[model samples]
Target: MSDSVEQQLSLFRYLIQTRSFGDSTLRFLDSLLVSKDVKSLVEIRSSLNQLLKSESLSIIQSITAESVHNKLIVLDFFVCAFAIVGDLESCLALRYEALVVRELKSATIQLLHVSPLEWLNFVEDAVKNGFHAVAVKACENALRCIGNSDVQKLGRDVISDNLKANTISEITRLRNFSLASITSRSVQVQATEYLERKTREQQKLDLPYKEKRCLASTSFRNGIKRQNMRKLYKRQTLLRANSEMQGQHPNLS
Candidate 1:
């Protein structure tokens, strides 16, 4: 595996562990993929869209506060992928916004299974466990807002508990595993790099340089004269690639 590949994977895991993808932050991720993967952000957008079909307090709690089956957010999602995965400050703000939206959208008579007693214990445990700012508030609100119904109450409690448990687990598992120690993740990162390199395509756009940039910035154009880009896309693609993800990770025997 290449060292460069290992670094990128390590960075990704570090972010997830940090709760960079908190409830509110997930919204921005949805937006980012939609924005960055311009030609097709719909895949990610769809995943988030499915979550907000109107959250039932009880339904959510089942996954958390009680013993029950849980759905995988991403199948084969590397257990390590939960590292600090985003800009923490920004995610905090997004979580606040999500709260406002929920208040507006949720049904008036909401209930959760977690009791007020449990909420107190959960909050204390979460704080000690070092949840991200947004995650802390989310669990707090989910606990407070959901009231009176065994199912809804249970669901909300579970959600909060789940958040706490997940944070603790990830932190413990990776506590000593630094970028230097994440071998499995690094190997996968290198594999992805090799796959992309092998699948590289050489194609002609049949258009002019300025026109291509204009299309990219403004709208996709149809017909155009064959001319070299004002600059090549390799430079453009490379510009966004992080230094960690850039270039070939030296092959290590």
Candidate 2:
């Protein structure tokens, strides 16, 4: 077999060994990797969605830390695979599901704790893919996790106080960045809706043709100006935030 095929087989076996997936789910993933087509992707997504639902129910029935951790690992693998195949929508959906699972686990068992760096990575990935809402939710979850006294005690036991402080500081910075991104996106959406409303109003107005034209032109110009200003401000805000993050987290690329 070719090296590429060998590598694929190796990865498939590794996934099977590591993830606690059922036979059907494994088959779906195998099909996805082998075909790398839309149909296969859809099949895998459907199978994984069902698995997530079942796992969620299982968690409710009995909240075992091992089971929750296994589910999270499977989800991480699914998200990474979907991303590799360039299925942003599926990846995002799976990522959100993983977040939900984490939240549920945190709420129920309160034993399986997700680290700040893991949350940071998820937020970064969400932001990079323009999933601002997901990124913001992730930031919120991360902040909540950090605020938990149990999680703080666990972190203190595992790492030095200085390291934990740095991690918390970085998570805060990323949370602010994610909030800004969502806010900018929200503004853009509102601006688009406002422009659309203005256009509809202009169309329905009972003014003279010249007056209508002038009114529409002015409205369009003003809307464009406002949008441009918002865009410029967003750029500046993001740049400033990124600069600060880089300066603070020199190890992050």
Candidate 3:
């Protein structure tokens, strides 16, 4: 391959490793398709498929987490791949996937330059497909991007009219329930910690009393043993004195 092709391939390799796609990456891929034969495109697709099939892609997806920007970059790579094969349906599907992921709706509209009505219809389709939460999120995102008050009102109406009532209610209830549970757990933890501290304090306070009682009992037992020894010694002495008196008085008897 030529030096330029080598550089492009290097850039492609770097982008794939980072799980990122940008305009430069797209241009590089497109250049490969246009300058080289169809085999180059096939090789590119094979490489992408290999990457996508690996555990790394799943890890990248998971790491995207709540980051809309990272999510958008991943979506862009998928879109670039689908666009390379001229698979419009697949490209649109990636956008739908982006809808459910956080902040990606706004990313999609910004990057794809999707018109207000097109995105509105996309959101509608998502609702019709039973992705109520996705639809609601997309509508909410569109409101921020769409500067026109008319379009904003239209989006608000779509969310109010077309989205499922139970889905929204359930989401709200779950969010509130989660907050309440967290608060309850925090309070319980504090109460348990306080009780444990009081118990430790009580044990500390009672320690000296317990020691004093033990020492007093030990002294009383020692005193009783000493008194018993004295009584035993006096009885032995009296017995000896009686024996001596009997010996001296034998003559008188």
Candidate 4:
């Protein structure tokens, strides 16, 4: 293999070993390899899946902060991989898993400090990729995180009120954007359905009229045929009467 390919493989191995999973990891991978490379994406996903599968059930069930954080990291990587592979369902599932893990009270805010920017990035990416539901879910989660958190609990000694306010503002804006997209999409679908239904109803309404017109045409043709038959019968009867009169008047001739 080429040196560049080897280097990418090395980096992938390091990422798997270190459990370093996030947007930066995805960016680095994209820089090294094509983002849409199915082979590379599948390889990374398989490795991550194996690692998760190898974990003990007991560890997963413990629900400690460390375990939750690690799980979130894996889930984040899974989401990124599934997204690149165009597996929207799996991507959304992993995102939801990450959100749920982050929401655990045992997952201390100090340890699992997901910034508003991170949430915004996820939401924006989801929206850009036509994952409005995922974007909306992310927005809701971000808002909930903000509402349930305080600057003091953020594990930052130098945090400010302004920072929290700004975070809230950003998340609210994202929420509104996602909601509007969903609403617009819903309205478009409803309008299309309405038009289709009306078209079908109009066709049904015109069917009887079409049948009536056909019946009227047939009746007119039948009436013309009956009138012609009567005229022919009258002409034949007059000719027969004339023949009888000629025979009876021969003696006078």
Q: Best-fitting candidate, measured by lDDT?
A: 4
What does candidate 1's lDDT look like per residue over 161-232, in tens digits? 555555444433333232223455679999999877666532233346666788786643332221234245
Q: Clashes in model 3: which pairs?
A: none
User: Which pairs of residues clash in candidate 4, taking residues 3 or more apart in a chain or in different chains?
Assistant: none
lDDT of 3 by residue, 45-79 (tens): 55544544453346446765556667666876776
Point to the candidate with the largest TM-score.
4
Q: What is the lDDT of residue 180 in candidate 2?
A: 85
1-253, model 2: which lDDT tens digit per residue? 3465446545654555544455554554545445446675555455545544444344434534458667776677666655554567567767777776876676566455666666777777777888777776777777776666342554345645676577777767776787887788789999999999999888767467878789999999999999999999999999999999999999996
> What's the lDDT for all of these models?
0.40, 0.66, 0.59, 0.68
lDDT assessment of candidate 1: 0.40
> Using Cα atoms with residue i matched to residue i, what is each candidate's TM-score against the true structure?
0.20, 0.50, 0.43, 0.60
Clashing pairs in 2: none
Compared with the true structure, model 3 gives a TM-score of 0.43
Task: Report the poorest 10 consecutive residues by lDDT, candidate 3.
Answer: 147-156
| Local error of candidate 1 at residue 89 (angstroms) | 2.9
Cα lDDT for residue 127, candidate 3 = 49
Ranking the candidates on TM-score from highest down gives 4, 2, 3, 1
Q: Is candidate 1 or candidate 2 better by TM-score?
A: 2
- Which stretches of candidate 1 lie above 4 Å from their native place? 1-85, 108-136, 148-253
